[model samples]
Target: MTPTHAARLVRELSQPLVSGAFLAARDRERLLEVLPSATGETLDAFAAAAVAVRRARIGDAASLCAIVSAKSGRCGENCAFCAQSGHYATNAPQHPLLPPERIVAAAAAMARRGVTRFGVVASGKALPDAELESVATALAGIAALPMAADASLGVLSEDALARLKAAGLAAYHHNLETSRAFYPSICTSRTFEDNLEVLRACRRSGIPVCSGGLFGMGETWADRADLALTLLEAGVFSVPVNFLSPIAGTPLANRPVLSRDEARRIVVLLRFLLPDRHIRICGGRPTVFGRDASLAPMAAGADGLMVGDYLTTSGGMPDADRQGLRRLGFVVAQAG
Candidate 1:
């Protein structure tokens, strides 16, 4: 398209009347036209537009989600990007699944801190029936809490998914990690389709799926865009954009980290594309944006955030996150 046409398209996108098709395509020429003109004022304009979009779809209310590393380390698959998998010699804490009491206590603590969604994450390819039963038992203890329960137990069987759903699991998280074309380069032990199957299993069991990708792991911009579009196609209810942390002893340890501006740019671009989905700022937030930079994401259309500490890493405290949201004039929404 000509420069004039591109400029016109960008203006059209900025307006609320544009069709969904235009946003879905997210034409590069249109983005370039507007991005070049994005001064501080334009950035705020974009942010305001994103907030309006988010409020219309999911409301101005933000949700705080927390996760517990129930089962840590000794993972079989060698996903070159992960720090917790046993395949990498990183000093990630390794232990069997925490006892049910500990899991229940963690859930209760998160509730006390105003977190409405509780997630349990395990590191491995998939869980056996015994392991699934263990997770189900943990979910049962916290059934009384108003918080919504979710799990990230790797690839799951039909029976496992059913049992978790029956135990009141509300959502399931299985990251695509990256685009299918680039997935093999990062993980050798598992296929991209294996992850897709797990998401499909979640859907089959009538649970909402929360799937997303990690950025800055030696992927091209096209790769990042492809990952976003893939998640859109997969019907993911929540998208957690995690930047690569490059932990010591991992294959990507020497890789350069992403700047906070670049991370925010991706979040803004994702808002333009997935205008109605829950876009969360997940792992690597503290290291990338610093603790003070939390509200920049909420201003850029992020509707949810992972609260408390992340797996094997310390994030900001829950009270601090709540304060940040309040300072920005955002009200934390309780999970239904």
Candidate 2:
């Protein structure tokens, strides 16, 4: 498309949101240009329109998941966006794996608070063998509860994933993090394909893959497009849209938080690209989306949310989350 086509393109993309049909991949560029880059009421209004599209396609019941930090700090990889990287002096907590009972208690608490999904997120490239076994044992207990269990234990071998699946792991949480072209700039410790291999291993173990990326880390609009396409290529059933929450000691510590409009546009793009996929707004919402953080993201076609604490950061309260969703006319999924 020519430069002159941008204005008309934005109108084309905006029309579908009102018409109750999702924008197709062919129209991604036009969709990207729909909202102004500046943060203002215009951006807010554009995002508000997506609420109808989200409701029409995905309904009012939103899936909420809580994550407990099973292990903390001392990561070997140098992912610039992470506070947990050992290469950085972020002073993020360092702790060994939680005992099986403590992990089980965390999941139980989430289940009691209407969370249907629970995740155990750890720092580092992979868990040690003993910690893996202990975590697997915890999963067995978590499975018996009312919630589905997931883990972000970093890269793992096929055999390791098989053991996790055997331990009642319903899904594997892995974020591709960003596009292939921009990945190396963010981390030299591992290739983007290394993350993909882990996803394939999870699939081989009969576990569904929940994959996504953290945006607003100096990536361009094109990079964002590539991230969406990569997640679709991975055949992920769910996508966690994370906005960068820069930590003071990391490489990207000085990066500004994403404009609320920019964050919402990221979700809108993913929803348009994968209309039926479970689009979830994950880490960094509180700092990124301003006061109406929760409502704006859901309005942008995200059907799931990471409702509790993150791997190294705090999250919004689950009680406030439920009440906010109710006020907005959306139902929190009762734990199954």
Candidate 3:
């Protein structure tokens, strides 16, 4: 399509599109159709429309989801992109599950930093019953904090999920990591369906699901689009778009870094697709997008962010993130 035609297509998409059933069919179709035509100004216009839609749906509110790697190292699964798993022999910290009080203290610190949601991330295929109970106790200890709590303690049974809910956990995060067809290439221990079932269990237990995938993991554009659509279809409430930060000593250590433009484009497209959801710029935000990273995504209508350091990487300081949000006229939503 010519630039003029692309501009018109963007304008047409920018209309006050319905986010519910009224435009569901058209919404998906339009997103798919405009994706190939996505370019510099055209992508920006689509992102602008997405931001407007998000503002209409969620207003100026933003959620701060903070995460702690409660248990680190020796993960049974070999997800090629991760540094925490021992399968690749990376220099990840190998430690046993932290004490409940220590975990609670970390949550308290995040609460003081104005984070509304706290997540405990453990590296493994699944936790044993004893370990799960320990995680539950840690969550319960942090329950009195005003912040909402979540845990990515690997897959869980119905009873385990219920235990977590009872312990004041409000949500569970388990990224499919990639599309179904591409999943096996990343990890052999778990199927894509296995991850989906965990998400389903969370939904059935009335817990909100936060799931998304890693980009630039040797996946195609179609693979990336399918990952986003799958998250939408799974009713994932929070979608974290993580660019693959290839860790040294891992299988993908020599992989090339994703370009900033490609990363920004993916975020913009995701915003257009999941306009009203919490499209969080997670994991490799700093390493991939650099300092000006947050601007385009926030302007494109991201509703939340994973603040502080990631599992094995540093990020922008909390003050910097807050300042960025303020500069963009986005208000941070405090815990009630």
Which candidate's lDDT is highest?
A: 2
Error of 1 at 264 (Å): 0.4
By lDDT, rank the candidates, best first: 2, 3, 1
TM-score of 2: 0.90
lDDT of each: 0.79, 0.81, 0.80
- Residue 158's lDDT within candidate 1 is 81
What's the distance in Å from true for residue 300, model 3?
A: 2.4
In model 1, which regions exceed 4 Å deviation?
1-11, 16-29, 32-44, 333-336
What C-alpha root-mean-square deviation, in Å, does candidate 3 show against the real structure? 2.1
Model 3, 239-318: lDDT tens digits are 88787889998878888888766776677667666666788878888777788665556776677888888898886666
Per-candidate total of colliding backbone pairs:
0, 0, 0
Model 2: per-residue lDDT, tens digit, 217-299? 99987888888888777789989988899999998999999877778777767776666678888889988875566567887
Candidate 1 global TM-score:
0.91
lDDT of 3: 0.80
Give candidate 3 regions above 4 Å deviation: 16-30, 33-37, 334-336
